[model samples]
Target: MNRIELATLIFDRLVSEKEKLKTEFQNSDSGIGYFFLDDLLPNDIALQIHDAFPKTEQMVLKKSLREDKYVAAQMNLYNPLLEEIIYAFQDKRIVEVIGEICNIENPIPDDNLYAGGISMMGKKQFLNPHLDNSHDKDRNLWRVLNLLYYVTPNWEETNGGNLELWPNGLKNKQITIHSKFNRLAVMETHNNALHSVSPVTYNGYRRCVSNYYFSKSPLNDSDRFHVTSFRGRPENKLSDLILQLDTFLRMTLRKIFKKGIKENPHVYKKEKP
Candidate 1:
């Protein structure tokens, strides 16, 4: 189905749970704010999206101590349905309703797909806890929310690749939100929203469609410009030290170069028409 049709389905589902989502996010506001809703779309449609994921070889392998996964923002090369679903979440009707649910006003969807798109994590791959880059690609707008839709069928928390939130920091245990099939999780992004994905244990892909909403104002007055920062899991002290140093160096380079020495290629650029 087209994006408009898909968006209608999304809005209907979300609005149906508006009150529950509002309270869920508010109750968590003392730390990182988040709310998740399962079965965001018809099971058959979600399965179709899952089946449309491109092979890992067709995507960009972003491997580092910081993160290990395959992501694709250049959507034209993949199945058309992938692009459709990604932007369907961007539809104004859905975006506004989501902002209302989270008590964020006038949220704007990112059309450039800067750091927004599809990702797949297979066996042994994982993302360390990190704060997302503070702003949109141009560093003009504050990134206020992350929209993650998981489509992998029959996935389980024990199978791994679960979403971990460090509301109390890594020194304490994290709260796990299973990467369940057809689950759509909306989490607030700000200075303190440190999150990551658990390592995938099974050989199946933990596929997700991601989108971010931006706003002219910061979520917290304490929010400041910072590069994406990373830290190893709680058990890896040495790795944590190294990753902290990595973040320091990157932040220092940005302080000198403003936009850093190299550009991030993780954005979609539509063909000149």
Candidate 2:
């Protein structure tokens, strides 16, 4: 029907399957933690979401990949139902349960939505492997978890546009999490958790709903202050060097200007009705 109904339906399904999903994540051998539910929502509903998403004009890129690897729409559209569904996940009870799956205790999401929004990628677009920024708007809270819901139908693995986790760093092999339809993949975000979206090779588009959960405490003590760090793939040594320098320069700038050289414009800006 609408975004709310679809989100609610998906939430109900996920809640109903919570125990199993939790167990799957807990038992996984991959330190690159995740849980996925198939056939999460009806095809029609998924199509509606893909169709209804707003333009990508307000989207921001932390690095070159967001521009080269992604062409996405942000979901700040006002819909009480969608908010309630998001709240269902935002609620402490749900967040705590998910936190338990990720082996974290008592987690809370920063009310301010930042780089959190929707994402879409078309052919030739690809997000290079990178770690999310450690903090939110004011740098007061640490982003601890990433909630990604893929809604693109029949998105094939061969087509690319999947999430990749490099828990062991870019030198080693990465764990690729397919951007499957109706799959909700939640992973821990931190300084060590290097991740990215594989390039979309096919002609079609891949769409996803993305949100991040933040907490007062850093995911780990070693997670020192840093900006969103990015790197080239294992094979791209030159790109890696460039990205490292890019991160260092940005972090250096942040040291000079605490809030950032300029405000990030990716956030949802509301206008009076």
Candidate 3:
């Protein structure tokens, strides 16, 4: 099915849990305001999305101290199903409803898919605890929420690749959200939304469809423009220190260059035929 039909399904599922999700998010505001909904679409349809994922070789590999995963924002290079699902989350009706649920006003989806789109983590791949960049590609809008839809079938908690949220910072324990099949996790992104993905131990891929919602206002008054900052897991103190230094250098360059010495190549640039 196409984006419009798929968006209708997504909108219906979200509305079904509106009150429940709102309460879940509001109660978690003490830390990270977030909620996860399971079985977001019909079983068969979700499986179809799994089948449509591009091979890891076809996607861009982002490997460093910060993260190791395959990501694709150049949707035209992949299956049409991938593009449809990405834009389905951008559908105006769906966007408005999600904004309402998260208490955000005029939330906008990145059609350019800046640092947004699909990602997959294979064995040993992990995303270090980090805060996402505060704004959209142009530094114009504040990124307010992260929408992650996991499509890996029969993914288990023991298999790793789960999402971990550090509400109280690295000094404290994290809240792990299993990357279960057909689950959608929506979390507020701001100054303290530091999160990571557990390293995958299983010899399989944990695929996810991601999107971000942006707003004119920052989620918190204390929020400011910053690079996507990273930290090591609690056990790796040295790595944490190194990542801090990395963040410092990047932030310093941003101050001088404004948009960076070279434009970030992570954003999508639609090709005209």
Candidate 4:
């Protein structure tokens, strides 16, 4: 199916569950609101998305102390359906419905897909606990919501690669949200919204579709300009210290160069013919 048709299907599904989603988001713990829906699309369609993911070499491999995963923002380099599904979450109707559920006004989707797109992780790959970058590519707007759609089939929690929310910080146990097949997880992002993906133990890939919604105002009054901050798990003191320092240096540079020294290359530049 085409992008518009796919988007319409998703919009109708979300509309049917709007009230349930709103209640869940409002009552979530640790001051960070969120909601997840399983079987978001038909099983066949979701499986097709998983099957269409490109090989790891075709995507950007981000391997560091902070993360290990393959990401791709240049949609033209991969399957057209992948791009269609990614942007379907960005459809006006879908965005508007999400805004209403999260109780936000006038939320906007990032057309450039700054730091947003598709990602996949193989065995032993993980992302450390971290807060998302505060704003979009330009510093003008605050990133307020994160949308993650997991398409991998029959993914088991024991296989890891699940989403972990450290809402009360690393000291307390995290809330584990299984990255189940055909599930869509929407979470609020702010200064304190720290989250990460567990290491993948299974040999098979764990694939996901990602998007972020931005607003002119901050999600929380205390939210301030901060880079993507990382922290080691509670047991890893040494790594935590080093990551803290890493965040400081990046934050300092941003202070001096409001937009950073160079343009971040992780954006989709639509081809014009």
RMSD of each: 0.6, 3.1, 0.9, 0.9
Tens digits of lDDT, candidate 2, 1-273 = 444455566666777888888887777525656777777777676666666554445444333633373322223553333344344456555566677667776677654457766666778788887888888888888888899878777889999999888878777888888998878888888778789888889998787777788888987888888888878888888888898899899999999999998987666555559
Model 2 TM-score (2 dp): 0.85
Per-residue accuracy of model 4 over 140-170 as CA lDDT, tens digit each: 8999999999999989999899999988889
Query: What local lDDT score does residue 173 receive in model 3, on the 0 to 100 scale?
Result: 95
Top model by TM-score, which number?
1
Please count the clashing residue pairs in each candidate, in the order shown: 0, 2, 0, 0
Error of 3 at 17 (Å): 0.8
| C-alpha lDDT (0 to 100) for residue 222 of candidate 3 | 94
Model-by-model lDDT, in order? 0.95, 0.72, 0.94, 0.93
Which 10 residues in a row give candidate 2 its minimum summed lDDT? Answer: 66-75
How much is 75 displaced in model 3, in angstroms?
A: 0.4
At residue 31, candidate 1 shows an lDDT of 92
Report the lDDT tens digits of candidate 3 across residue range 1-273. 999999999999999999999999999988899999999999999999999999989999999988999999988888899899989999999999889888988999999899998999999999999999999989999999999999999999999999999999999999999999999999999999999999999999999999999999999999999989999999999999999999999999999988789878877799777
Tell me how far the alpha carbon of residue 227 in candidate 2 is from the true structure, in angstroms, after superposition: 0.4
lDDT of 1 at 39: 94
- Model 1 lDDT per residue over 180-246, tens place: 9999999999999999999999988999999999999999999999899999999999999999999
Judged by lDDT against the true structure, how good is candidate 2?
Answer: 0.72
Pairs clashing in candidate 3?
none
- Give residue 103's error in model 3 in angstroms: 0.6
